[model samples]
Target: MRPVDGMRVDVLEYCRVLASQLRLAGLPESRVRVVVQDVLAHVEATGEDPVEAFGQPTDYAAQWARPPGVLRVLGLMVATAVAFPGFWLVLTAFTSPVPWGGAVRVTPFLVSAVAGAAVVGGVYPWTVGLWLERRAGRRVGRGRSPLDAVVAVLTWAVLIVLTLVVVQRVLGPDGDGRTLFSVPRRVLLAVGHGGMALSFVLPSPGVQTMPRSPADHRSWWARVRSLLAGTGNRRRF
Candidate 1:
């Protein structure tokens, strides 16, 4: 492998590290490969190794491959353990006896119960994901965190509460059970389920701390808009 002048690393090794990070960041493999090649060329022009210019060896490895198969298995196990409470709440929702003679009352207790499920079930997985990304420098997968389990239950709870609020507003507080469980409620529930799937199914964002480059910069207008929006401007803008 050819070494870049004034750098102690091989060109291929540098590309390997860059490509690995792009992959972790949830970029498509084809796109990541293309970006890695472009970065390699950019560094070659300056006679410098891309990996050394970008980050340390451990950072590159974590971006590309770390935690191995065993770590992944353990991480998933931890996630599953954390999500148990939410799963139990779901079971309770369907199996437990209805209160107030099945009147479908939108009670505070019910809302709190669901919220508790979300908190209990989501905390561990979310923490694990955050920890892995920060300390291990990798994006933990959905099944790899307890928070993954809570996403669906929490989404369900939020959707249910929102739907109930809308319904109560439209039909009044004394709305009957029949109206509450009607076609409209069914549609809302379906939407909630879809949201749950989306929240969990998307790939996790990877750990990233590399300094931006000229190529990484975006248009000034985009930057201004992102600043105003107050959403994260990590990548774009």
Candidate 2:
């Protein structure tokens, strides 16, 4: 691999470590993801190693750690480990046997569930562990520390299995008590395909958020009027 590619991979690995440490310190996953994105951008822009640029993960995590009390810590732990993952799995279960206009065949049970998860990942990417982590981060209190994300993954592995079960149950053959099961799964597929399509059409997220040039900061009306005045001046000359 090229040197830059190697650095990028190392940086990505470091980001995972930083994220874990940050979560252990109690930062929510959304904040951690954003922080990681920012770190990536910074590293790419500066062409520097993350550790050299940002310091060690442990020390960096400390910067974002929330003030700890027993109550808040405990509450956040439950929220991350249980409530967050539980809701998503239930939602995932609801989405099953995603239709694809017969483009891709979905087998029953294991194949169906795996296909459903992949569909969710391919188009919508909602099944992504990182994205889901960010979603869980939404439940965190603004006042709480960000390291709670560490506890966030505590139950995800198991929850993913449960999600598979739910998808199976939801996708069980119709004309049985399973009629309502397909509704959620269809929605999941719809969302997945729709999101994937939209991704291609939309501008890149980084570019959308990129800082404007200093000159672009001029008031828009002022800019227009100035342009007009300049045009008239050139014409007169």
Candidate 3:
């Protein structure tokens, strides 16, 4: 949290807030950095307080914000939800000893996986944005507390238990659901592998390429420490 040379503490704070706001506005890290650096350079040249120069960080960022489209968000969520079932289909195709033409019943576990993926896809973005927003407002030099970790773990555990309970209740002891369609095992295998390969080549929606950095060569522990300390290259301002 120490300010870089020639950067005041308040100016550093302003940069942090601006970066956070830009990220919350759905700007990629690279774009956020470019904007933040421009602001920093302006403040440095004029020797003006950032808030005085640019107004509130949130308001300033709103000018540049391009919120993702509803269709794009929904598409991402559907893609995420399908990934689990796709993986399961591939695994089952490989392992099942049943005849190639046999029908595969949709099970409760599959249903649960889809439901979990949908929930996660819908909630994860907002949760992360809120977490980062809160962190940005915290006093400089303060890191995440142990209680935050505990609460996060507990929340996930509760969600998992509840999902399993509900799935079990609805699906009963047999955990069976109606058969949707039948396909040959060979066809399933081919489709599954093709889907997996396509997933690797496909560009994820809303993701922007990150610029290369020296930190990419650092050890995992070093990277973890930098992240925990909030002292990455992007934070130098």
Candidate 4:
């Protein structure tokens, strides 16, 4: 085999080992796929040695096996904090127009209690969690862990409680019908998630999860800068 072919094999072997270790560690299959996705993206982006860039497969998986990073977990929690309230406020638009809105009006103390409960909740409510939820599952039977259940329960509970509080505060004790109607929040969320889940039910004709690695995957701002930088051709014209 050629030198490039050997390198490619080595990378694939490394990915396999990493995936096996994570699965053995009881990390969910979806989460394991994400780790592989990240590794492949990094490898393709910068042709650095996989071992050099990110140690061994078992070591990387071990870190995930261990408790999450303190600050990183806290940051995810903060995102969930903002997102939960935002989702509720979005829902208030619908609930406000209907009757029996007064009963749903959450007292300030109840708001504080629910937020506090969510703060103590053990959940990864940010990017990773969102990614896992969106990924379509093809298999018919899969047993979920209690931790996954806890995370999901805490997530929904937080959103529901947060909605009540924001709805009451903004729309008043008896919610006014006037609100943002351009988008129906609940229906949008349901349809979007449902479609995403349904996509995985049957084999897709020509869809691959992660296709060829892009030459550049920089942020929008970075791309904008490059686009704005003229190559002196504009002056020539």
How well does each candidate superpose onto the true structure, as a TM-score?
Answer: 0.30, 0.29, 0.49, 0.30
Stronger candidate by TM-score (1 vs 3): 3
**Model 1 per-residue lDDT tens digits across residues 147-228:** 6547545655665566556545655555233332312333334444544454454333232333233354566687678778
Instruction: Supply the TM-score for candidate 1.
Output: 0.30
What lDDT does candidate 3 reach at residue 236? 45
Residues 1-237 of candidate 4 have per-residue lDDT tens digits of: 022333433566566656655653456666777787788779889987676677665566777775235575455455444433333443443454444323233344434434443443324333335323322111101222456557666666666567567656664553333333234445534543443344334222112232212333556675567558853223211
True-structure lDDT of candidate 4: 0.47
Clashes of 3: 0
Can you list the residue pairs that collide in candidate 1?
A: 79-145, 79-146, 125-146, 125-147
Which window of 10 residues has the lowest lDDT sum in candidate 2? Answer: 203-212
Candidates arranged by lDDT, highest first: 3, 4, 2, 1
lDDT, residue 54, candidate 2: 75
Candidate RMSDs in Å, in order, are: 15.0, 14.4, 8.6, 14.5
lDDT for each residue of candidate 3 in 1-237, tens digit (9 for 90 to 100) = 332345444666667666666654567766777787778779889987676677666567777885445665555445554543456567877776676677554456656664664455334434543454444334333434677667556656665677767876887654245444555787777766765665553333223233223225567698779888877756443
Best lDDT goes to which candidate?
A: 3
**What clash count goes with each model?**
4, 15, 0, 0
Whichever of 1 and 2 has more lDDT, that candidate is: 2
Q: Tens-digit lDDT track for model 2 on 31-62? A: 77667777778988988877667765545656
Candidate 4 wrongly placed segments (more than 4 Å): 1-58, 61-68, 98-212, 216-237
Candidate 3 Cα errors over 4 Å, as ranges: 1-24, 28-30, 36-63, 66-95, 98-105, 124-140, 175-237
How does each model score on lDDT? 0.45, 0.46, 0.58, 0.47
Question: Over the full model, what C-alpha lDDT does candidate 1 score relative to the true structure?
Answer: 0.45
